[model samples]
Target: MVEPVDPLQRLPFGARGPLLDHLSRLRHDLGKYVSLQVRWLGASPPPEALRQAMMADLLETHRGPGGGIDAPTVWAGLRPALVGEVPLDDTITVDLSGDVDFERLDDAMARISGVVRDLRGGVDGPQTVATGIEAARTVSDACRALWSRLRGG
Candidate 1:
């Protein structure tokens, strides 16, 4: 059996404009929140009052060149604050080649499997509940195994 060809691929050059537009809008909206979060994280170390004051200034005032906070101040805090923005904007893809250490993922998978097993075992009082628990446990096992293999075991 032949799979149907994707019609979208047959459209005029890169005709995914609408889809791209929608995604762009979504990214922009998400960027606003990310920007706010970045600002918040930068100010996190300061006392609350100082943070609030800086936040008000940053939000409300437009600074002339060399006018507001000194260059060193913004350079120090802003760099760390914007740490995850490139990934957030979909501009920079994290090269997970060596970064994805699966040790923690393995631990999490073990915990989840143990919890599922425990829950299935705990549902022994009712026959219908026991059946449901078994079904759920089977599904969880399949998914957990698949995920473990996908994440390089």
Candidate 2:
């Protein structure tokens, strides 16, 4: 029987740290907002469970057998979280009437798409830095969207 290789091991040395760090931060940022949304809806947030699920999905989607980051797969995993509607109760007094900043979200998605493309081709120092910056920006944009939805702005 052949041993399965760890896909993460295949990433370039310079790229691996930044990419992993980006993923970790992204998960943290999103999880924070998710918890906030749940609370806003008068429900308790399942912090650990949500974090674990998000991390697992991200790892499965990005860490392929060939060691290449799949942009589509990453997008697929993110789309639900990015565009999902929070279940609000009519009896709840929280304002839940606002348009999401789709433009910002789209830009963030585009940035991530570019990062995935660069990773697949092979990341150098500059590319790694750029990807990290973009990943942070993406997280910011997502948070903004969530806030907008919650505020009805």
Candidate 3:
């Protein structure tokens, strides 16, 4: 993973606690989005189709192109990395692995967008780093595409 532009590890303990706590929560929140994405798509999803919101830090580890990170694969990676076993499976399943397409995709993304917006709104103060902001924005923008065009946020 790229070291954050700021040397976060060097901060003094008292000053660091809040930032560390936020970062940890940030990780779980991002992971939750991916897990929801996987279950929404089914047991297997075409990562390429959902590639627009790829997590920059996970791209190399997932071994997919930067633009095509496999979200289902990343979801597996997120499970072990969760802090204190936070559950990320509370998502509505849309099942696009069969005949359904855009309608299911749009519905899934619209629901996903709400979670993404909540995640974005929760980020503040020390948690508003570029990586966090960009990740949230990427997913929010991606999820907004269909529903925003069809209706609104």
lDDT of 3 by residue, 1-153 (tens): 854332222333343334334334433444345434423444444554334233232232234355444333443343232222432233211211221222333344344344434434653232323233234344434333322332321
| Total backbone collisions for each predicted model | 0, 1, 0
Candidate 3 differs from the real structure by a C-alpha RMSD in angstroms, to one decimal, of 19.4
Q: Name the top lDDT candidate.
A: 2
Off by over 4 Å in 1: 1-15, 40-44, 47-153
* Whole-model lDDT values for every prediction: 0.32, 0.41, 0.35
Of the two candidates 1 and 2, the one with more favorable TM-score, higher being better, is: 2
The lDDT of model 3 is 0.35
Across 1-153, the per-residue lDDT of candidate 1 in tens digits comes to 976543323333332443334323322322222123224445335444433333333232224475543222322332221223233223432211111222232233343334334434553223433332233233334333333333332
| lDDT sort, best first | 2, 3, 1
Global CA lDDT computed for model 1 = 0.32
Model 3: lDDT of residue 61 = 20
Q: What is the lDDT of residue 104 in candidate 2?
A: 49
Estimated TM-score per prediction?
A: 0.21, 0.36, 0.24
lDDT by residue (tens digit), candidate 2, 15-89: 434433433444444423322322343333364443333223223334447863333454455444323332112
Misplaced by over 4 Å in model 2 are: 1-72, 77-100, 151-153
Which candidate's TM-score is highest?
2
